[model samples]
Target: MKERWELMDDSKIVQLYWDRNEQALTATSDKYGNYCITIAKNILGNKEDAEECVNDTYMRAWNSLPPHRPNILSTYLGKITRNLSFNLYKRNTADKRGGGEVPVVLDEIVDLVSDTDDVEKEIDRRELVKAIDDFLGKLPADKRSIFICRYWYFDSISNIASRFGMTNNYVSVLLNRLRLKLHNYLLERGFEI
Candidate 1:
C-alpha cells in the first residue's frame, strides 16, 4: 500500500498536525526520518540515542504546531533533533562518551567571543540573541550560510568547503574572518566581549 501523505507537500503535512491529525506524525517521519536521524547521529554518535531523539522531535512538533507553524519544517525538526541529541549526549557522558563534529565545532568558536567576568551584567541573553541575529542579517548570504552550517548544523569545515566548492583552508579562513567580524560587532554593541 502506498502512503498517501508521502505524496503530500510539507505545508500539507504541517497542516495535518495543526488539525490534530495523527497521520501528521507518520507523514513527517516518512519525509524526514532519515534526515533527522542523521543530524542526531552526527551529534550523539549513537544509533539508539539518535533514534530516541528523532522520536522526541515528532512529539515536540506535535505539541508546538498549533501555536507555532514553521515556515521551514525540515529546519525546525532538525533543530529540535539536534537539541535533544545534545541533551541526551550530556546526560550519557558519565556512562559513555560519543564523539563526532561537536568537539571540533566547539573548538572552532572557542575564542570567537572574549570571556567576560559578567556577560549578563553587560547584555541580557535576549539582547545578545538579538545582536547576533542582527549581525547575521547584515552578513552576505554565503557567509551567513557558512556560519549557520558550521555552528547550527555542526558541519565540518571539509563538508562546508565541499558544499561551496572551496578548499578546506579557504573555508577555515572565511569562517575565522567571519568570527572576527562577529566579535568586533559584539564589542561595538557594548557586549563586553
Candidate 2:
C-alpha cells in the first residue's frame, strides 16, 4: 500500500494544521505516527521515551507548519524526533544514567572519525545521502530493509535476524557483503578510512 503521505498533499496538510483543524492532527498521526515511533524507539530504546518523543514531534510539527510549510513533512517529523531523542539521551548521559541503544550504536562509528574533524569535511552530507539513496534504490526491498535495519537503524545482526525470521549467520553474511560494497563506494567517493 502506498503511504498516506505519498497520497495526500503535504501543502494541504500544512494548511489544515494552520487552520487548527483537529482532523488534520488526526490525519497526521494516522499517517506518520508509526514512522515517528520507529525513529524514536530506535534512538531512545525505551518505549516511554519514544512515545514522549513522538508526541513532542507532533506538537512541534503542529506549531512549526504554520510558519514553515514543509515540503517533506515526514522527513521534518523524523528529524525533530531524532533531535529530541538525542537531546534526551545526552541529558541522561550527562547524568551518568545513559540507557539508550543509539548511543552505543553510534559509539562504534565515533572512533572511525577524528574527534576534531567535522562530518561534512569527511563526507558531504548531501552527497552521502544521495549515494545512500542510490545504493538503496538498487537493492531488492528485503535486502534494502535489512541494510537499513542493520546500519541506518543500528539494529544488531542477531536482533535483525530475529525480527526478519532469519538465522544470525545469514544476517551476518548479508551485512558483511553490504558493508564491503558500501566501503568500496565510500572509498571511490574519496572517503578516506
Candidate 3:
C-alpha cells in the first residue's frame, strides 16, 4: 500500500512547501528519507551519521524552498544528503582511519577530477562541472549509470557489479578506463588537467 505522501506527486509536495505547509516536511520525509539516507550512508558508512545528515537535508530543503524551487525534488534532496555526508566523512576521516568504500572511491577519480588547485577556482568550477556533465551525457547508458553509481551515489563496487551483472575485476577495470576517458575528455575541452 502506498503512503499518503507517496500518493502526492513531487509537484504537489513542492506546492505544499510553497504554501508553507509544515506537512510538506512529513511528505518529503516519507518519500525521500530512505533515498537520502542511502546516499548519505554510501558516503558515511554510519547509519546514525547518515540519518543525521538526512535530517539536515530536510532542514536545508525546508530553508531553500522559500526562494528556490527544484524541478526534481529527489535530485535536490539527494545532492544535499550527499554533500552533508561527504562533509561528515571528511571530518571523521581527518586522520584517515575509517573503513569504507568512500575513501577508495574518491581516490580513484580525485586526480582525474582535479590534478591541481584549478578545481577550486569558482569560475572554472562551474564550467568544468558543465563539461563533465556533457561528457557523461555523451557516454553510453551503462557507462554513465556506472559512473554516477560510483561517484554520485558512492556505491560499492560489488553493488554496481551485481546490479550490472559484471565481474568485480571488470567493474574496476571499466571504471579505471572511464576515469581515463574523463580525463582526456576534460583535457580536450580545455580544462587544465
Best by TM-score: 3
Task: For candidate 2, write residues 25-133 as lDDT tens digits.
Answer: 7777887889888877777677888898888988888788778877888888878988888888787778876564676566544433323247755556566667768
lDDT tens per residue, model 3, 42-128: 888888888999999989888999788899989988988888988888888996644557878878877765544644677778888
Displacement of residue 83 (Cα, Å) in model 2 is 2.3
**Candidate order by decreasing lDDT:** 3, 1, 2
lDDT of 3: 0.87
Model 2 C-alpha lDDT versus the unseen true structure: 0.75
TM-score of each: 0.84, 0.74, 0.89
Which residue runs of candidate 1 sit more than 4 Å off their true CA positions? 1-7, 112-123
TM-score result, candidate 1: 0.84
The most accurate candidate by lDDT is 3
Candidate numbers sorted by TM-score from highest down = 3, 1, 2
lDDT of 1 at 182: 88
lDDT of 2 at 77: 84
Tens-digit lDDT track of model 1 for 1-193: 7657667888999999999999999999988999898888778767888899999999999999989999999999998999998898888875767776787788877765555547654656567789889999999899999899888877778889999999999999999999889888888888765
